[model samples]
Target: MVPSPALDTAARAVPRVRPAPAPESAPPPRRGRRAAVVLAPAGLTLALGLWGIRRQNSMWRDESTTYQVAHRSVADLWHLLGEADVAHGLYYLLMHGVFTLWDGGLLALRLPSTLAMAAAAAGVALLGHRLAGPRAGLAAGVVFALAPAVQRYAQEGRSYALVCAAVVWCTHLLLSAVTHPRKRTWAGYAAAASATCLLHEFAVLAVLAHGVALLSARLPEPLRWAWARAASAVAVVLAPLAIVSQQQASLVGWIDDPGRPELLGFAIPALVGLGCAMAPSAAAGPVPLRALALPLLILPGATLLAVSFIHPIYVDRYVLYSYAGFALLAGAGLEAALRAVPYPKAGAAALAAVAVAALLPYSIQLRTPQSRLDDPMAAARAVRELTRPGDGVLFMPARRREPILSSPGEFRGLRELALARHAVPSGTLHGIELPAPRIRARMLTVQRIAVVMDPPGRPLDDTPQERMKREVLDRSFRRCAEREVRGMVVVLYARPGAC
Candidate 1:
């Protein structure tokens, strides 16, 4: 049949159909670009983190302790672990392995911690991404990587940095598993949590914090059940270690409770510290309090107070996990605050200014060894200079018996300096040698006896040795020479015949 005009128009207008858009292609994620943007700041933070790796006070007493314990033979370390520090034996063992390749100087001893700080920075980034968004994660990582406290420990020869790194990673994995419970995520959580415990006993508190954060999310029963299983597995694995090191329980005895005022002081600054931590370089002004409010300001401070009331053990540094919390909160706050300002760029500039300003003092302090710690190397040098062949150096008061008598804790550097200088007979004086009569008699034969004192006071007089030295030895020998160096008094005594 002949087609009508309307039918003809309809046939001509008809078109072939095509497939619909394929799920919008997810807008290309922009993940790479976002990561690049975040990484720029993170890289700066990492640079700053490693900036003063060697510019610390000569290894302090605590650092010396780490070096001494870690450098022992494996068998020796095992034998001494229970007596010395069972709690940190694993850390010493790990560091011991690292020391085999390099001598245990400040740099070599602290290198692992520096690397651990870098890993922590990476964990911060991953955590920020997982907790908030990619931007938050980036900022958090940058903040953590550049934090003064983190940098401080990162450059020190201790286990705190490694513990910090493990905790950060464990938190990251923990939050991930909480958000999406699966076999793989649970496995990661277990591994990270296990490592955290191995790194430091205090890390258990951080696991508790993770539990709190997770419980806040209100996950379903299945996920919760799975998480419980994973956590239980970790506890099972770590219980034996904890039992073996039960002696560590005594270390907490010396801990004093922090009062409200002390808590407030620490809490307030910890928040500010977060801002300085996130910013690449700080400004020349104060850090904003807003940035420190969440994890930094309230959570850590409050948690510590709560822990103190319940467990009665609260030391500031022991809550190093609080540092990570501060970094995260600061990053989130800075990002949020910057977004709210009229000019994001200007806000960023202002924030950057404040961050740099705040960081300057800490940076300078970190770079100058004497600024952060006593000059142990100088003390060692002083000891070396005072020693002569066949001359015996005695630490006064007997109880002060150590390499320098004034500072025994810097044993690592002290011993190294002693070995390098070939100064033999560097033993500490016995308590018995301090008797006035004994000291005077010994000086008669030991003509070159040198006396070193701390805080500069006259010799003790209670002992018979002191009376004899004052009555008899004082006339026999003149006070030949004395000088003060690095907060110590060095007095040289020469016999009358020798003089």
Candidate 2:
């Protein structure tokens, strides 16, 4: 059977039913706009990232962990990883290099995440343009830049943004391999998938997403097997990290099993992604948006949430790359919507304005400290002003020591009453504290103590150590000066007559 003479020489026969693939349904030409389409949203993301990069110079609990851990010497970092966060070893090493080159404090800490999110926006735009059109691509990129979740993680010091970027670009690479069918392309895809899984093991979920995409596209059997081989290679390469990180899973024991709110979170956005994915695309590529975006948007989050019932590793940020798929669908949906309406250009402009108006308040809120669960800097200020020389400070649950650890010099004048070993040397998040008897003995000698505690009504830790701290404080000391700061309760305790 001879190939159709009208089929372009460059594009391969991706499907037996179709004559050609990539160029078959291309929209009317305004060529050479691909670079601009990718760069535009990326620039917007970078601007949004830099707009309030400092978050009023406040770092939250996780950011504090990143900052302090990344600053450790290589030996200390490696040793610490063996004990605490082996999953984050690569990210910590990357951050260590960033800090070594430029000690810009908060700026250095979070800039990598911001830049990586910008890259993700670029990837989304390129993908949207390939499937829908330049307009859809540009819109998708901008939407990604403005997404509240994207904005939230973009300003943090973490690996999720980088993982998001890798997933988005690798998805684009998957489509490229489908149309072009080159060993180099598949190799790139496998390599990227491996790197993404290395960044965080949860990204293996994206591999399952790609499988859904390939099956849904109904591509040729050869293509499916090729993808399978590539995916298998990724899984094999990731096996070591997966095995090692299994031990680390217990580190996130704090995560609760998915509940009603988790269901609502996945269900609502999932419906929207589905609608947009099913909408018509004016510019069509080799792959269908429904086949690609819907699975990418739905599978990772839903699977992880479901798995949380057994292992409890679900986190919204862990599947942050899902937003790229949503952005792609949204851009295509907007384009299809405008095409359906009269006076398309006017509808597009009006839609853009409406989106900006609706998102402005949330955008403003994203730049503030209140956007996160808690701000450590707010409590650090209280600690700085309250402590006098010769005072002793006690972190009731030990993890409450985060604010002082974040701001190294803040606790200078006060002795750490409960700590037996410092965090860096002990290779722990918070330093190891004394046994219950030792803590009680230390407390008995202090005339004045500053007790750092969690906010009211959080469940108590049922350990002997906590029982000792509470009983000794209640029995021997009088609360003198008490202040409530963001995420913390700082109280001054004194011997019965000292106050």
Candidate 3:
């Protein structure tokens, strides 16, 4: 049908309607200032941590293991992959690449770990800021930097620091994404979480913690969906590593039980460490229960205690991530207590004073004898100086023995290998790996010397602690010279020319 002339004219002359402009939320002008404030704590913490690491002792046993494993030939390392510690394959490969560029000395070996710990402190600060505010971040960062446990691990060459860093950053990103439901934040959370898992398997605990945090906060459905999606992505990426990690699960069953007293002592010391780290001594000592929230302390303390009883899977290093939570709780508790007093600033000032007082003493303590980890290089030097051509070396237990004696880090199958390469013909013996009869017979025939890392003592029974101690030492030799070098105890010995 043909349109009417009037209708056609009306349509042609159509009304002019303007589309509405999209609404724009004003950008926060003080955002930059707030960001600086939020990050200030983390930055200062990182700086202090770096400084402490510079002044810290050299690499110890675990660090040594990292270097040796990393330095091994790819073929040899591949063979090792089928053995124990397939869980650490990626970390070993990464460290191996790192050691190739630099001599695996103390500084070179530990640089990566130092950086990792710094990153972890920053992540803790970010988490605090997101959970509370910039002030909370500041408190958390400073406390984290000064944290004796963090300093101890950061200064060493190990995977814990790296794993801790990943946990913190991933936690922060996950929380932010869940709180805001942004694709960028979700993406970041997924990536960080995956990296954390690669660095250490225990990092999966952060995911569990994140879930708890989200549920506690009652996050929105859309945000939860985003978080779940990010989590799924991380799980997918980590599947292969998970499969490989299964190969090392057998080690879990071997974890020695810390007796009741030992467990309690460990728990108390850990809590005290946190108190000393976060609160000023004045505050922690005079008014710890009040200054730090009782509920905050009680909840976690109970959880850890329960974990010890239920699963019995407790280690100082594994629960290291809990430090972040403790720091946050400490800051909040301090803030809450301060708010209760007549003058908020006075309470804060008093708490700050206490924090400084508490930390200074422990920081001094850390610089002293308590921080000593190991000494392999000096021991090696001593052995080398004493040994003549064709002299033989023997370790009573094999698992803790390595050729390179300078550092106390993990031997990574390198102790015997290195000694053989550098000091061969003058071979070494590890009783644990080699049959005791063969080792004894070999020692009887050769110009044999024994060096035990521990003090002079008889071998213990085949209990876990005794085994661990025995394996770590070289026995069946007498000390010729004992000296302390770089916080390590070195002993020299020599066997009869022909036994």
TM-score of each: 0.72, 0.92, 0.71
> Mind sharing the TM-score for model 2?
0.92
How well does candidate 3 score on lDDT at residue 337? 55
Residue 471 displacement in candidate 2 (angstroms): 1.1
- Residue by residue across 342-455, what tens digits does model 2's lDDT show? 898999788779888999899898888878777777777777777788888888788877888888688888888888999999988788988999999998988988888888
lDDT of each: 0.61, 0.86, 0.58
Error of 1 at 299 (Å): 5.9
lDDT of 3 by residue, 1-499 (tens): 9889999899989987999864566446566555665566656655555565534444445565676777776666766666556667778888878877887466676678777777777776665555556665556676677677877777666777777777777665664565566678788888888877777665666665665555554556666677678778878888887787576566566455557764674567457545634533222111122222222323343455566666555566765665666666665545555656899887777877887788777766565424565445544555565555555554433433543434333222222311222311122111124444444455545433434344345343464433432333335444565655443443545343333
- 1 versus 3: better TM-score goes to: 1
Q: How accurate is candidate 1 locally (lDDT)?
A: 0.61
Measured with C-alpha atoms, the lDDT of residue 475 in candidate 2 is 96
Give the Cα error of residue 83 in candidate 2, in Å.
1.4
> After best superposition, candidate 2 residue 183: deviation in angstroms?
2.2
Q: For residues 1-499, what per-residue lDDT tens digits would candidate 1 score against the true structure?
A: 8879999899889996898775654545576655564566546655765677677436554565667666667877776665446767788899888888787477778778877777777777765665556666666777776677776777777788888878777765665675566789999898878777877766766766655554544556676677677777778867867886665566456466778776776767665755544544222111222222234334555666777787676666565657677777777667776766799878777877887899888777876656443444454455556545544344433322333532443332221101111111221112234445455555566565555545355446355544554455367666656655444555655677664
